[model samples]
Target: MDQERIASAITRVRETLAEHAAEMRYRDSEAIATIEAGLRVKVNGPHGASIVTDMPNGVGGEGSAPSPGWILRSAVASCVATLIAMRAAEEGVDLPGLEVMVDSESDDRGLLGIGAVPAGPLSMRVIVRAQGTSDDARAREIIAWGKAHCPVCDAVERAVPVQLTIELPGS
Candidate 1:
């Protein structure tokens, strides 16, 4: 979207969050993904939205969809792009050709249970390109601020706690 439209959307989002501060801040949400027998995973969200993920055929998967890691990369890239657009809009900078690329670096042996490597990506690189604007400095400022403010990026960078539970069929 153009600067004006983006600004309007950002304002709406901010207002909504502020107006529903309590509910928005502490909403109970969970991602549900189910796999029947193989590596294919189906994730369902509200409003009937869904996503399917799979590993490659070589790894005993259907290979019909993107892998889970691909989804993670997409989430990070898209979130950064959205925040950048919002910041640019706030500053009235037009970015008609904004683009973002996310590169996830992982060790194959990690997931394969080799050595002591981690199962997640060791590092990630984000490339942001802005076009249709000659304000290079302002564009850089927006990109920097937006990238810094991305929640997904922060989550990936920082350590977060996770709990595991095993459910049996009957008892």
Candidate 2:
């Protein structure tokens, strides 16, 4: 990891926030996906990155990539890990090995239309591990701070309103 670059980026963000308190609100970003084949989609990220998602063979898909639920869980884990690193850097703590694992129980009954279960994960668990000079108490404090400050963690823990609209070709 490039500690210098990470520190510089964090410093820049802090400076920007201090300078533009009222104008720092970020606009909504979006990820676009298009159907490729049966139960398969090609997702395009804001950057040049792209990924493919497909269902399991049992679900009548080719199982090319991971399912959406797995992707969501991975996103949560990655976000937490990044936030932890950033927080540690800000606090002058060296975390040479930081890892985050996110586990969730997914209920597919709603998707299958076999039951009335929720369409999302039933529950989630997050585990963070890192090696640092700070004591256990300070480590706990950092984890707590990350949980409270991480946007993805907050979104997962809270209820977010989602509005879906469908557009048909030629009206």
Candidate lDDT scores, in order, read: 0.88, 0.83
lDDT for model 1 comes to: 0.88
Itemize residue pairs with steric clashes in candidate 2: none
Worst 10 residues of 2 by lDDT: 131-140
Compute the lDDT of residue 58 as modeled in candidate 2.
92
Model 1 root mean square deviation, Cα atoms: 2.2
RMSD values for the candidates in order, in angstroms, are 2.2, 1.9
- TM-scores of the models, in the given order? 0.87, 0.89
**lDDT for model 2:** 0.83
Tens-place lDDT digits, model 2, residues 1-171: 566678789999899999999998886667899999999999987768787899999989999999888888888898888887778777776766778889988778978877788788889999988775557787777777876788887888899987889899997
